[model samples]
Target: MDYIHLNEMEFYGYHGVFAEETKLGQRFRLTLSLAVDLKQAGETDELKQTVHYGEVYGLCKDVVEGEPKKLLEAVAEQLASRVMEDFPLIKGVRVLLVKPDPPIPGYYKSVAVELTRGIFV
Candidate 1:
């Protein structure tokens, strides 16, 4: 199995439990790892033989920037589920969602949620 990784993809989104957060929005970073068998693509060098990363990025962007969700868990869940559903060749997906500046008063770098979905062989 081979993996395609998209790291630190940034976006602005209105996803939070607080009304102020939803109104103003915040920065989000997403890291996605998709597992697939790359043997066919490696041999044939055909676009159709493997997942198109551009399309995957577009899907992630749409989900991240489109709707207002209350939790990062929901966001991660949606992303993982969509990626698996949209690409049949993908055996699994791991999604990490990071919120750089959470509403908490504590001093910290960021809050993140990581989730994995689908079957791996």
Candidate 2:
């Protein structure tokens, strides 16, 4: 299996369990690993044979910055679902969602959720 990686894509979003978080919004970081067959792209050197990076980035932006979900899991699920549906070449995806600021009283860099979805019809 071949992979296309998009790392450290950042956006502003309202996603958390606290009211302040939903109202104020915060920064979000997404890293995606797309499972695709790049044999054709390598052989033919055609953009059509592989996924378009801009389109995927746009989709991620739309999803992450669009709505306020209570949990990072929901955001990841939605992203994974949309990616597989929109891109035929993508057979699977790894979605890593990072929340740099959480309301929790803890000392840490960030909190995150990662999910993998694949083999969609």
Candidate 3:
């Protein structure tokens, strides 16, 4: 099917395995691809026929900035779960979570995890 994409959503949170990491927190970037049937919305031109992306953005902000998870995988899971729960038209979700900076001693753009959940998976 069809897709609605929300890209490069940024947030700050404490999410890491290290002690300092949990205390200091870091920036996170999230991207969501919502699998949905947009034909109804396109045809009817009704807001309810499609997923409201504004609500989705708030939901992503809450999950990414709310809790401290040791792994990006867990964060991705939570986000995917919520999207499926709150939006009925959303058949599935693809969550891409990025940790812009980590305590790891290396040179890289970032560390990230991608999760696919529900019918879209």
**Candidate No. with top TM-score:** 1
Global lDDT of each model? 0.94, 0.94, 0.91
lDDT tens readout by residue for model 3, 1-121 = 9999999999998888999978988899999999999999999999999999999999999998898898888889999999999999999999999888888898999989988887774
In angstroms, give how far residue 66 of model 2 lies from its true place. 0.3
Clashing pairs in 3: none
Tell me how candidate 2 scores on lDDT.
0.94
What lDDT score goes with residue 72 in model 2? 96
TM-score of 1: 0.97
Error of 2 at 71 (Å): 0.6
RMSD per candidate (Å) reads 0.9, 2.0, 1.1
TM-score, candidate number 2 = 0.96
lDDT of 3: 0.91
Off by over 4 Å in 1: none
lDDT (tens digit, per residue) of candidate 2 on 29-63? 99999999999999999999999989999999999
**Over 4 Å off, model 3:** none
